[model samples]
Target: MAATGHHGAPLLVVMGVSGSGKSVVGAALAQRLRVAFVDADDLHPPANIAKMSAGEPLDDHDRRPWLETIGEWLAGHDASGGVVACSALKRTYRDQLRHHAPRVRFLHLDGTPEVIGRRQSSRPGHFMPASLLASQFATLERLAPDEAGEVVDVDQSVDAIVQEYVDLSAVG
Candidate 1:
């Protein structure tokens, strides 16, 4: 079956803190939806990458350009549609994205700190360290009632989370 969003074609932003499986789930969602997939991590500036690699959390000033880049990518796909994996941790960040792609919706991967911490620790060679997990959790802002999206718990299999997101997003 052809995949669709609450609207016709969908531009989904798979969002969460680090280790919430945004990349894996976003890729699967894009595949299911038969659309392009882009990981926002790849759009990060070298300075941001260096900061994260050195165990520093980025301030808003450090992230403006990166957010603009991701927002531009989303806007570029306005007609065709796509899915993007992004750590849209703050409400302001998501708002910045919405400015570029008004029709975009989010799939927030929610999880407890313990769950995310374990995943981060087990994972290796990533620019973000497990040490920064706390900061990630602290930075996360829950989606508001007016937000056009759904939150999927990350305790289950990636497939389950993706399925839930697809189902929910299709409904409203």
Candidate 2:
């Protein structure tokens, strides 16, 4: 995989609700783009982890600082961008990530609840247990046309998703 148009561009946020293949597709896109990849989940504070680990959902208050952290990190990747897998379910979250890297674009991994739930149930050893998936869906804010994001349905293979993303993003 080769990165095509990203010689000088802002970072990309491969985002969606939980279990939407953000990590998988983001990794492939990063490889194709020859850029670094970061799992935004790792940026969450212990409190956020603890909350989720305990089968609890985080309120917007809990998400703000974490979003800001991501925004701050984007400063470094403004040029020679990278890809980050993030469950940025809300427009505000995406906005925050873009603040530091205005060229930041989002790739939303859209999927049905049945599809995503099955995918989540198959994975293990993650803080985001399947029990909390309902909360994730409840919190998800669909991408509107006015939103600065590209929606990619997750029914196809990861390669296809990456290819679609690459095609949609001129910077990819």
Candidate 3:
């Protein structure tokens, strides 16, 4: 079933740098909200994946199409609502997403680089290498005051993070 809170079915983007637990938290949040979940990484074009796999940071040109694809997904799910895990690391990127999915809300999983880097190192088989984490951090723009979003500390347990969102959404 779709979320039936004051906001109705909510379009949520779980966003952060690599290893900030976007995927884990997004999945759990979607389950709790009874909404569908998707990992934005899966929507990337093969070239983007290959560039990241080779330890190269993707430039805006490479990410534009990918971001548009994600936006399209959000548009398609606007009525039903859904959760997507994505590294929406720049204000412009988030703006682009909002252009396509105006009602979308973001959950930024924030933490120190030391904490996140360690987590990135531990993950194997992921296309994004730890070497490029610095680039991601450099690109990240925290949600502005006017943005429809919340920042959650990634240091907390997954359940705790998910619960916090659940509580916040309940009040809205």
Per-residue lDDT tens digits of candidate 2, residues 51-108? Answer: 9989888999999999988887777877777889999888788777777878777888
User: Among all windows of ten consecutive residues in candidate 1, which has the lowest summed lDDT?
Assistant: 1-10
Better of 2 and 3 by lDDT: 3
Write model 3 residue lDDT over 127-164, tens digit each, in one string: 99998988999998999999988888899899999988
- The global Cα lDDT (0 to 1) of model 3 is 0.90
Compute each candidate's TM-score over C-alphas.
0.96, 0.90, 0.95
* Best of the two (1, 2) by TM-score: 1
Give the clash count for each candidate.
Answer: 0, 1, 0
What lDDT would each prediction earn against the true structure?
Answer: 0.90, 0.82, 0.90
The best candidate in terms of TM-score = 1
| Residue 126 shift from truth in candidate 2, angstroms | 1.2
| Over 4 Å off, model 1 | none
Write the residue-wise lDDT of candidate 1 on 35-141 in tens digits.
88999999999999999999999999999999999999999998888999999989999999999999899999999999988777878999999989999988899
In candidate 1, residue 52 scores what lDDT? 98
Between candidates 2 and 3, which one is better according to TM-score? Answer: 3
Q: Which portions of model 3 miss their true places by more than 4 Å?
A: 1-5
